[model samples]
Target: MRQAHRFGSATIWQRNYYDHIIRNERSLQPMRHYITHNSLTWADGQLHPCNPSKW
Candidate 1:
């Protein structure tokens, strides 16, 4: 976005992002949980390079 252009760095924005319509509340709850908690597990995930065990 504009911040990435202004900073001359897009380390986070370099990844693809997407948006979707929430047709029902039932579907939104899971996405809400994931959005709130996903980052707590990121460092331990295989896709990420910084595993806490290595520290």
Candidate 2:
């Protein structure tokens, strides 16, 4: 999911993820928050009958 968003395409061929370093804790916390909150944030998309809970 993260790869698809960052690279603008899925990496399903590899069946894995790539990572990059975060500069510091200051940069890291909000990213954690977003990841943690993502399910709620995108719930409407999941709720749509055709979308099928991308999470």
Candidate 3:
């Protein structure tokens, strides 16, 4: 908290980071796609700073 206050940010990190569990290939494929394409799809991604769309 001291570092955050020093840097003038309300919080230095999110309350929680996201996680996923892959049990099978069906579930794994999409995760692989997203991880591999995150950079390429940044402009259209849900987490993109400039993107207004929400997942």
Candidate 4:
């Protein structure tokens, strides 16, 4: 957020973030897997602002 401000751009002027709460293992495990592979998955997930492809 501070970086965006320093760049003279509002964070919201760019994109939104996606977050999920820690649930039970069934749910948590998938999120952990996602986090571990975020870079590989970014091209096809909501986490990448430039990627419109769905997860």
Which candidate should be chosen as best, given lDDT against the real structure? 3
Predicted candidate 3 versus true structure: per-residue lDDT over 1-55, tens digit per residue:
7867998998667788667899999999999898889878888868676876664
The candidates, ranked best first by lDDT, are: 3, 1, 4, 2
lDDT at residue 37 of model 3 (Cα atoms) = 93
On a 0 to 1 TM-score scale, where does candidate 3 land against the true structure? 0.44
- Clash count, candidate 2: 0
Worst 10 residues of 2 by lDDT: 46-55
The estimated TM-scores of all candidates read: 0.44, 0.39, 0.44, 0.45
In the range 1-55, model 1's lDDT, one tens digit per residue, is 6766799875764357777788899989989999879988877776575665564
Q: What is the lDDT for 30 in model 4?
A: 89
Runs in model 2 deviating more than 4 A are: 1-21, 46-55
Backbone clash pairs in model 4 (N, Cα, C under 3 Å; residues 3+ apart or in different chains), count: 0
Compared with the true structure, all predictions reach lDDT values of 0.75, 0.71, 0.81, 0.72
What range of 10 consecutive residues in model 1 has the weakest lDDT sum? 46-55
Clashes of each: 0, 0, 0, 0
lDDT of 1: 0.75
Evaluate residue 19 in candidate 2 and report its C-alpha lDDT on the 0 to 100 scale.
71
